[model samples]
Target: MAQQERGNRSRRSILEAAARVFDERGYDAASTNEILASTGLTRGALYHHFPSKEAIASALVAAQSEALVVPDQPVKLQAVIDLTLEFARRLQHDPVLRASVRLAVEQTSFSRPAQTPYEQSNATILDLLRQAREQGEVLPGVDLQEATSTIVGAFTGLQVMSQVYSNRQDLPDRVCALWRFLLPGLATPGMLARLRTAPLPQTAPQAAPQTAP
Candidate 1:
């Protein structure tokens, strides 16, 4: 058990190091040596953990994609918005993510073939959109494929925009605003109303029935 824990720790260190190195050096320019040096691990250790630099990059991409989805959220448009806002907070805090975005922006031709990590991320997001449709959360007239692609594409564009102005703190807020605009038209009226006009919980407990005293 202890050995397994150590292995996991080592793997995380490598990924974090890769994020930093890749962010600083861009894909073609980034060196395995730099990644290894950043983590203070031996070359052999890195090789054991990841077969190649592309492998590390792919893993990092997968991690970032997974991070985009907030856990335990329902399948409504508002839920997706809430989850994405939370994820944006994470990107704001993590330098690695910031760096990755920079790399993605600069490397306009970094497309992986089919069955790549990015494709997997797309598939997962599409599945969620499909689920929302199945649950009758989206409007009846919405085209499932087009809506999914558009929403994902919008978020991707937002991410790039956020990277451009990352020095400012309002990126996430702006992205949320975009979602608010999109949700009303895309969601069923019930879902839209639930998100827009949902009442806040009355935190102050009502006093127990007052006795005549």
Candidate 2:
């Protein structure tokens, strides 16, 4: 049992270190040596857990893709808001998520394409929007497919901008502003009135200071 726990810890450490390196240097430029150096682990230890650099990138993407938790709310629109706000919060604090976003965007540079994470995210948002439409939480006549695509695109753009401008220190405000601008057009009057867009509770570890590549 102790050995298994230690193995899990070692694997997690490698992933986190790889995430930081990837987030800084991007996939093609990021070196496996840097990842191992960051983890303070020998090559053998890293290879035991992950066969190659691509494996580490794949693992980070899969890990970040699974981190979102859909809140249970009577008004599914509110749940959607919660989901976006929470993700923004995580993006500010979580290295793995930051790396995942970078990988998803720059995946064309990689030998193997990374598509599942984006597809999963889109599917999750689309599912929630569909439910909101069915529950009448969305404004009348709103096209859910378009709305879903817009929301995902807008949210991704906002985070990228925030990261560039302020290292995501302003992400909470940007996300709040995003909702304030979007909710009126997206939500029913009562749903909009009831929705809360204040900063969500953050449970992730504090982000380390980012260094330029």
Candidate 3:
């Protein structure tokens, strides 16, 4: 049991180190040597856990995907808002999430396209929209599929621009602005009036940390 615990710690250390390096240098430009240097782990140890650099990148993506927390709210549309706002706030501080976004948007020769993360996000939003429509929170004639795609695409674009311009320091504000523009088209007038576009209180529940593999 002690040996298994140590192994898990070692693997998490490697992943955190890799995530920092990838966040700073991107996947292709980031070297395995740099990751090794960051972790102070011998090549054998890293290889034992993650056969290659691509493996590390894939793990980071999967980790970020699993970290997303969608709240269970009586108002389903508000749950969607809470999810996006919390994610934007986390993006400013979480190195693993930053690396995941970079990996998803900037594909390299070694990495395949990042479809899984986007697909998962789209599916989650679609599900929320379906529930919202059923509850009459959504505006009439709002196509859930198109709304799902638009929200995901716009959020992605906003984050990319925020990264370039403000290093994501303004992501929460940007996301709030995004929802203000988008909600009118998606939510019923009464629902829209009740929704808050500003960042939720910092006391809002956050995503739980993922367990080490």
Candidate 4:
């Protein structure tokens, strides 16, 4: 167990060191040597965890979408909204998340293959939207799959734009604006009126009396 825990720690250190190097120098310029130098670990240690830089990039890309799990809410639509809000906040603070975005942005210019970041994001939203629909929070005519696509695509665009324009400092506000625009089309009138576009403080309670069936 101790050996396994130490291995996990070593892998995480390599990933974090690589993320920082990728964040600062970008993929094309970032070297495995630099990543190792940042970790103060031998190249063998990094190679043991990740065989190549591309593998590390892929891991980071996958990590960005999978890392944040919002607290569940009785109002499923609000949970969806909170997911985006939480993601926006994470982007402002998490270098791993930002580095993932950097690799995605520059992926086409380099050897990194096309990735499934959107597909993963879409699945999460689709699950929430399905739950919302079952609870009558979603509009009767809304296509949940289409809504999922739009929400993920719009959020992806906003992440890039906010990073370019404001270094993602305004991302939370931008995400709130996104929810406001999207909710009108996706949510039932009662849900729309009840949902809060802004994220509640982290310390705030998450549960609400379940909405009427």
RMSD vs true structure, all candidates: 10.2, 4.2, 2.7, 6.3
**On residues 37-132, what C-alpha lDDT tens digit does candidate 3 reach at each position?**
988889999999999998888887776566568887889899888889978877876777777777877763255674556888988889999999
Q: Is candidate 1 or candidate 3 better by lDDT?
A: 3
Cα-based lDDT at residue 19, candidate 3? 85
Backbone clash pairs for candidate 2 read none
Which candidate has the top score in TM-score?
Answer: 3
Q: Give every collision pair in model 3.
A: none
Ranking by TM-score: 3, 4, 2, 1
For model 3, the run of ten residues with the poorest summed lDDT: 203-212
What C-alpha lDDT do the candidate models reach, one value each? 0.65, 0.80, 0.83, 0.79
Write model 1 residue lDDT over 96-198, tens digit each, in one string: 5555455554454465344443454466556777777888888888776676667666766787777668652565776667777888778888887776322
Identify the runs in model 4 with alpha carbons over 4 angstroms from their true place.
108-115, 202-213
